[model samples]
Target: MEEFKDQAMEQKAQNTETEQEMEANFSDMEAQMGCKEFHPGDVVKGIVVKVSSDEVLVDIGYKSEGIIPAFELAFTKVDPFALLKVGDEVRAEVIKEDREGNIVLSRKNALFEEKIDLLEKAFENGETVTATVIDVVKGGLLVDVGMRGFVPASHIERGFVKDLNDYLKKTLDFKIIELNRGARKVILSRKALLEAEYQGQKESFWSSIQEGEVRKGTVKRLTDFGAFVDIGGCDGLLHVSEMGWGKVAKPSDVVAINDVIDVYVLKVDREKEKVSLSLKQLGPNPWEIADKKYIVGEIYPGMVMRTAAFGAFIQLEPGLEGLAHISQLAKFRVNKVEDILKAGQEIPVKVLEIDMEKKRISLSVKDAVDLQKPESEAEPASEEPVKEIAAAVEETKEIQAEDETETTQTTEFVSGNEE
Candidate 1:
């Protein structure tokens, strides 16, 4: 029994040795085939075991070592330090055979094929890819899309790009907008990626916001209606009505392009991603203090800005204007308001009335003139009726004298007739 058990163990050990030897022989055969079959333009798999100033050594199990020029290690720039490191496994194409019987390899060509594969997958799936801008060339920027790719300057942003060099050395996320592998043409868009992200982020931000938050923003554009401001990477409308408590003739009067401003949140609608902001709400209302500065019978100097048949309007400040009625144009002699007031003219007026809620101020130019003149001189003479009464009395007296003269002449004539 003991002899039989030892015999079984010996057989098992012999079987294990044979399997090991077979594996070793297979490995050698594979190595020999790899070395013998490799030729120029053929692809080979290897590990980067050594890096030198002029070449990189790749171990492909060949009898003669494979060598790659230092420039090929980087694929573009000749940076030996950045290109290859020990223990990095890479695929390369056989470029040539050196006189020393060593195989020369190229990593750049291998990388090109790999990039083509990745690009095909990305285009098929409509996926976003990230790239780094290597340099800014005429008409476009050279980018690395896992390999070298071209990004037209027009496709860099939503608007015109002023400085192309600003994008150099910058990694950007982009979409494969167009690709033609046969023609070796590819088009990438950074704007498309930004727009998609902007839409989603804007919706999410709008959903999270409520009333009563101060936001930092940049002025994107100006129009007659208002200015479109970029608020925290999203756009919001700052309507003319919400621009200020005082009047605003143009949006540029308050904000300029690329200006940074702090705005108070008025409303936000996530369904539309529409947000409203108020720059006026940041300060006290000027109209609230208007009543305190102006009151009935108070005279103040103002600038004339507009004129009408009923009144002449004066601007107290940049925005506030008050109307002076035609009846209050002057103390007495002025027949027309335009005669004394013209646009852009400076004038003094007295406040006759004020309605804060209505935002109306009734001003009197007559009162201002009266205050400047002597009271007696300001009082107009009452002449029409008095002159008429005096003329009537004189006419009565003349009629009575004529009647007496007629009576005396008649009496003298009768006495002469009787004699």
Candidate 2:
């Protein structure tokens, strides 16, 4: 019985040494397998080991392979097999450890984090970022610039935008006007970039623009006094007075919005940053050859255009108007100019004087009528004949009335005597 106890003790010591050696070998194997401890929210890099429709398995130097769900592979729904394949590298964020001892990772979250860092840098540096417009929401547009970004309607263009749906699904450049990482809010402006570019063009335009230069322009808007035209990057005023050589009642009559036209640069005010443009100057000036076209003491057909307190304005032709003074409306005295001459009335007038320097022409309707008279009646009639004719007619009427009154008075006197 004693010999048996000694043999049993030796066997127990040998088994204990074998168990320690096995434990050391297991530790060495674990080290070889790269057993890294990962917790939730840890970012990791790995190579894609397996790609399936539902999930993508990545080797992240961990005991169990990292599992990325298909839904977590991107911000939007995507096919994992098409997006990733075996041996492709990827970055992911650790979400949690699953019950199967597998790591739950999110590739979308990792991409989002990286994009936020890049966007933050872009915002600080005033750099432009590209984004795809996804939806046209109320008051603005929703875009995906690696994340949800909003562009206000007012900041979408240099002017008012009537429709926001026109920008749907279109990719455009933007400047980050506001950013809040905590709230995950981002505000972008395409107008800011457009304005910056326009300002550069505007500076170049102002520097190179010269007076009397003809430029192609689009009518932007119309006001009571003029139309604002977009001549390249700058807006210039096309005044109503300069729209035509003839009278312009309204600016709309000359040019409509969006009409492309040629304009003459009349003047440039650099101090005020104002440009005066003209449309009529692109054509010939009728007043330049008025003296050659018209002669003094000659009769011409004219149409009454408008009347003033002083006289009536008659247009001999387009862009050529002369005033017929109230005293020269007719051969007879005129109480009111409108009584004799109406607007749009065609009449003949004689030019009495021409002042080419002042651009004034003195016209006479009475003189024209006198020239049209026969030579026998061409002599100037004296006022005495007119007064004598009126006086003699009044005397004859007075004598006939007096005779009737005397006959009635005599009849009354005779009737009284008989009584």
Candidate 3:
């Protein structure tokens, strides 16, 4: 019994020593954690313990939890409940100790530091980033690119943007135009990215386009002389002269804003990056039918559209016009074109000569008037005798009687043969 008690006491002492050693080791480890060494501006890694609407409690392996205010939780204002949850480990900056013995931490300051590092690498590599437009302020826009960034109005697009409100809630790709860690300012530009993309498309369009190839284009804008059409990648000039076969006094007369039209690629200057387009070239030329349709000595109807000092311009068709000299305005002499002819008057005109190459036709109004009737059709009333008129009428009656007698004889002979 005594031996058993001694062995039991020895075992109990050994167990107590082991327990004391463990406690000492645990205390040394807690001291080594150095929670007290954490000061303002020091970064600490912590796991989230509790999350509220406005604040987050984090366990930094310290005796007391660290409290992070909502305003200090992100690069911008944020709700702690939306960001942090229990058991989520995060890195934070220690601001100071509060009166409640809680360590004050700022997640935004820590996140700001991390984003600066990322931006430095991005700027060095010439990389592009995506961001959302948060608000439009004076002279520029505020965006979120993992941090608050300012994009000037001039940097929003290739041209000046009048309505900055259109960019609100729009997500766009941007190039980091300027970044400063010391100033804590980040500037972004969407225009730079668009320009780079257009440069590539312009090159491809220029190489693929061939003369005479038809392309669908949109009428982007109109000038006094032409319409600037956007044919996918580049703006092409569609001159008023090439709008159609008919005369167009102004570019707006042919097309309106945002009109879709098929245009022929007339010319391409790769060196200058210029394109010439034509809407008429896509259709058949009206001059092609002029030679076949217009014949010399043919009398056709034409409208007197306008009168010149020397002659009158008569329109035979939509694109075909001919000149009638003042001398041919009437059979008799006229002081002015208005004396015998008026605008919008339709009259028959004889084609005297056709110059298809020059797109000109010499028309004679007098000849058309003179060719009304031939001398063989009827003689003069005075010269015509009454006896000749009566003889002609009697001959017409005799011929009709002879035709009836022949018909009766033929019918009687056929009936007798059948009998």
Candidate 4:
């Protein structure tokens, strides 16, 4: 019994020394953490111990856990449970000590200090930053670039945007155009970034583009004379005359805005920075085969496009036109071509001649009319001869009959006298 008591006393003494040493080590660690050095405006690093709906508790090695109210957690409204979790390491600024002796902390202030430095550096270096569109206010958009940033309506795009709501909840890249730390104002521009990209593309396009090459383009806008097409990064003019082989009354008839089409690069004036594009050149040229399609003396259906005092212009096909002179309009003398033929009149015309060298075609309406006559009307000479023969035969027969009648009368008279 005595030996057992002695062993118990030794075990108890050893346990007491171990507890004292552990307490002393904990005190030294608390000193190292500088818990006594905490003051308002001081930044401290800590680990998240608890997260609730209204607040977060962080262990900054203080006597008690530091309290971060939900409002002080972030610049925007956020759920504490979503923003923080137990054991998450975070940095916070000491706001004050509450009456309950709990250290008040702000994660928002700490983040602001850190983000301000980055924003300033980006502004000075002309670097781009990513941001989220938060709200669309009057004349501009509000974005969250670590803090609130303003994007003026004019700076939203290269062109005007009719609806700002389209950008809501969208993440886009932006350049810091203006920044005022004292005023807490940050102005950003998404257009600046886009413009830079466009300019770069334009330079590359100018260097590589060549005439006679085919390219795809989007119709940007339409004018009375032509359409402006965006080919890659640069705009080229698609003239109305080059739209098709046939005459185009208006550019809108050929293409509308925002239409994608294939275009042939006709000319590139580097000195003027102008490019001329053609849509018709991609297909076969109708004039090239006009001689084969149209033969002299052959009649073809044509439309009278327009008539002048001297002649009427007739369209045999989309790109092929022929001239019918006033004399050729009809067999009779024609003083005015318009009196005989009007615009939009459909008629058959005989191909008189095709001057391949001059690209001119001569047509005759009178020749077509004569060739189109009925077979009986066309054989007028033969019919006249037949009629003459018939009349002569009938006249001879009548003379013979009259002679017979005279002879008969004379015989009858002689016989009656003799009787």
Q: Among these predicted structures, which one has the highest lDDT?
A: 4
Model 2: per-residue Cα lDDT over 97-145, one tens digit each:
9888899999988888999999999999999999999888899999987
Quick one: best TM-score, which candidate?
4
TM-score of 2: 0.61
How many clashing pairs does model 3 include?
Answer: 0
- Order of candidates by lDDT, top first? 4, 2, 3, 1
lDDT to native, each model: 0.77, 0.85, 0.82, 0.86
Could you list the CA RMSD of all candidates, in the order they appear? 22.8, 20.7, 14.5, 20.2
Estimate, for each residue in 58-148, the C-alpha lDDT of model 4 and write its tens digit: 9998888999999999877889988889999999999999898889999988987889999999999999999999888999999988778
Q: Give the TM-score comparing model 1 with the true structure, all chains together.
A: 0.60
List, residue by residue over 262-318, the lDDT tens digit for candidate 3. 999999998888999999998787778887777787667677888987889987776
Model 2, residue 358: C-alpha shift (Å): 2.9
TM-score of each candidate? 0.60, 0.61, 0.64, 0.67
Model 2 residue 264 distance off true place after TM-score fit, in angstroms: 2.0
User: Global CA lDDT of candidate 1, please?
Assistant: 0.77
- Model 2, C-alpha of 391: deviation from truth (Å): 42
lDDT, residue 271, candidate 1: 69
